[model samples]
Target: MGIKVVKRHGSSFKDKLYLPAIAGGMKTTLKHFIKNLKDVDNLKTMQYPEVQPDDLNERYRGVHRLTKWEDESEKCVACYMCATACPAECIFIEAEERFDEKAEKRPKEFKIDLLECVFCGYCVEACPCDAIRMDTGIFSFTGDKREDFVLDKKALMKNERSKDLDND
Candidate 1:
């Protein structure tokens, strides 16, 4: 059977004039402007850098960081799970056979292109050894060069939030 579509009639006189809509928008703008002007302190905006918001949620997924073992060794076994799960393909890892018998493999070169990362937390979830996490509380990053955005193993290890591991 064919579908039947019903079309609505033309706009009313007020809708055609568009004056009522314009007036409504102006009224809202004026109301907010006056209210804000009267009590400037009531404004929700913060003087960032100097005054940061205190209410950062506990579950806020900030930036990626590699975890370290108790002996200060990299915990990642370099299974490529994180890289596989990364939708943006920002995670890059190179596995190498470990010299130590205890650990079979280790990451020779682990890198994450922050510029391409979507911060979906999939990498964190895919990690089997609890090696990767996004709990640095560092959402903002700036750099002069493109290479600066690529987080190497050293940088990832340095950025580790130990407190986040403790919480886990």
Candidate 2:
């Protein structure tokens, strides 16, 4: 037996009219090209670093940041909740017991590697004490070395949104 191929229907009127459809598409393309060529400056493109868009909203997750007080004191209670909740496992924290005339457990070291972070915002959401925050509004983070992206307590606290924990 011989293999066979069959077509039940012949080409339709629309199939025969492909050239006009192609011409119509080209016309639309040309119209856009002419319009863009005439007003190239009006194109929707921004010169980054030189010009940037305003902050989108409070919910915009850009960078990972740990909170501090006005006195440059660490706001994190070192509950390990943020670290546990972090999907990327980018957060590192070490809690220590301290006495402020009253004994309390607080974080001695808190670090977040922004390079490894996915900006999921789970840390901020999981914080029960509102100890951590990502309200710096300074979203852009770049550095040459891998260690540079590891944001420590000092760097995170320096953000404008963070208060001075030490003085407070």
**TM-score against native, each model:** 0.82, 0.71
In candidate 1, what are the lDDT values of residues 30-144, reduced to their tens digit? Answer: 9999999999988988898888556666678887889998788899999999999999999999999988655899999999999999999999999999999888888678999
- State residue 39's C-alpha deviation in candidate 1, in Å: 2.1
Superposed Cα deviation of residue 87, candidate 1 (Å): 1.3
Instruction: Please give the lDDT score at residue 24 for candidate 2.
Output: 93
Report lDDT per candidate: 0.88, 0.76
* lDDT (tens digit, per residue) of candidate 2 on 1-168: 897988655377876768877999999999999999999899987789898667456666665566655665666777899999999999999889966532277778889988888888899989977777776666677788999999887777666552312223
Predicted structure with the largest TM-score when compared to the true one: 1
- Root-mean-square deviation of candidate 2: 6.8
Identify the runs in model 2 with alpha carbons over 4 angstroms from their true place: 1-33, 101-103, 162-168
